[model samples]
Target: MENALSTVSSTLLSFFNSQALIAAYDVEIFEAIGDGATSQEVFEHCNLPESTGHQLLVAMVAMGFVEYRGDIYTLKPDMAPCLLKNGTQYMGTLARHASKFLYPLWANSAQAIRTNSNQRKETFGDERKWFDILYSEPNDVADFHAFLSVLADPFVESFLKGFNFSPYKAFLDLGSGRAALPRAILAANPHLNVAVCDLPEAVDHMRQELMSSGHSDQVDVYIGDVISGDLPEITQDLVHMGWMLHDYSIKTQKCILANVFKALPSGATFIASETPLLDDETGPTFVALLSINMLISSDGGIESTTAQYLDRLCEAGFTNVRAVTLDGPRTLLIGEKP
Candidate 1:
């Protein structure tokens, strides 16, 4: 009974943990205590009031994000990569994104559930679609893409290890935010042609990134919208889209799949990566909660099972549709055009 009660209590108070972490990132507490710092030194460095700053520090310590010994606080060694700004897996961008956008929008989750719709209008007073409002500001767009690239790092590493790219000569990534996968692909399979297609709003940033990385001549950038079926002429023998199918309703997902199918060459391959529910419809806790986040934030987006994804791919004129398990969080749904 005590263990059950503790679990319930922790679940109820999870937001406290989240907010405290976000607060730490907001005040640059983690960065301040990089090596180690006394409480007074941390408070002074962050310009935070001693009293409340101490309380926040205590919360972080209790949450296992920080260690307190000898009156000095230090970021947990294992957490440095995720907490520090310069670390490869830096999560400060995601923390800021959740604090500014997801936290506020989730306040209306109940109403969204009741209405079966997004609460963007209620939360932000903007009735426009999710991407429109999210990408409206340049900073917001940058933050969104930055955090996504951080999240995609693990998947990219796993993909490079587990997937075989030797069969394909040309590779195109649709809706490639940050072009992380494409760049990684180019590095791993230098013999193949790599390209990225994204919305017009995102193409400029991608071009600049490629130019700065000295990949401008190697990787091509094109403007396209999968939902509108406005793709460039399909020449790539292998195409991939990552973490994009779940951003819309079932109908829209089908539309995107069909559009991709129609655009690809007769013998081309297509793959999409997604975090899907289990066959039993049980929760993979994060994806389940993310489905709720989608309910409250997106336009009819929801989580689907692996079988459901394969069905959608088959419906979209894909043959030999199957799920490819990777050494990462996302599952890749592969299909061939015949």
Candidate 2:
């Protein structure tokens, strides 16, 4: 009976902690309960119906999101990952961005299916100008990069640990924003010579951070559009494309991959670290959430699965392909030329 009860309880908690639960947490119902609020108080605080609020509270308590003692309810530590404000493991953004923007746009994915068009009209109307928007608007740039960095955190040590970077004469980080990803990797591989390829505005920010880190000489700046601008023909042993390939359409991804394929010397490696969509073309739910965000935030990008990426790499004539997950969805897709 105890074993059965535990199994039943686990199922209930999983259901309550789903994306819907995060939305409730976003509205602060869990914290209010922790402050010794009643069901009616929770309803008033969250602007939800009293009957509905009571039901949700009951579920939350059963799921260990809240503990009820008579009329008072308190939040549980296990549930804090979604409820805590700005907590390190806080997953509230999944609900905040997922529900507010991607959810609505995803509701129209059927329209895209019917018309064979991008479901988001507004995102596509600007001719992929969202890149420029993210680049120029400092706040948005910082926020999105922080979001990406958080996603990359769990996987950092895996790829960082796997490769030795000292052989490289120089490192070129393509589409490097704030350059934090490379920053951490550089710390791990101290002898690496580094130069970031990004716009002038972004390099100004990168310079200060790099200089302060005592890497003023190890790291330098190259201002150019990596796609169209003239690239340095240095033939470095390692070039990084962290979290970048999924941001382009397959055609563009192939083009970019082909360019990098040609640029690398023998035994050189190209690393693309990102959350895996799925092995099949159909994505895992977490990646589906991000893919929809890409539709809304980017003009022409969607999260492609490992199969799709491998296809692009093979098509571009890079013979070696490997995928390894560090944790959860955070993964590395490494390709080497034969």
Candidate 1 lDDT, 229-310, residue by residue in tens: 9999989999999988888999999999999999999999999999899889888989999999888999999999999999
Error of 2 at 3 (Å): 21
Candidate 2 has which clashing residue pairs, if any?
Answer: none
What are the per-residue Cα lDDT tens digits for candidate 2 across 41-112?
A: 888878987887787887777766788888788777666654665665565544554554455565566565
Model 2 segments beyond 4 Å from truth?
Answer: 1-75, 78-82, 122-139, 166-170, 176-180, 198-224, 229-235, 262-267, 274-308, 317-331, 336-338
Which stretches in model 1 have alpha-carbon errors above 4 Å? none
Candidate with top TM-score is 1
Give the range of the ten consecutive residues with the poorest summed lDDT in model 1: 200-209
lDDT of each: 0.92, 0.66
The clash tally of candidate 2 reads 0
Error of 2 at 43 (Å): 9.8
Once model 1 is optimally superposed onto the true structure by TM-score, how far is the C-alpha of residue 250 displaced, in angstroms?
0.3
Please give the RMSD of candidate 2 to the true structure. Answer: 6.3
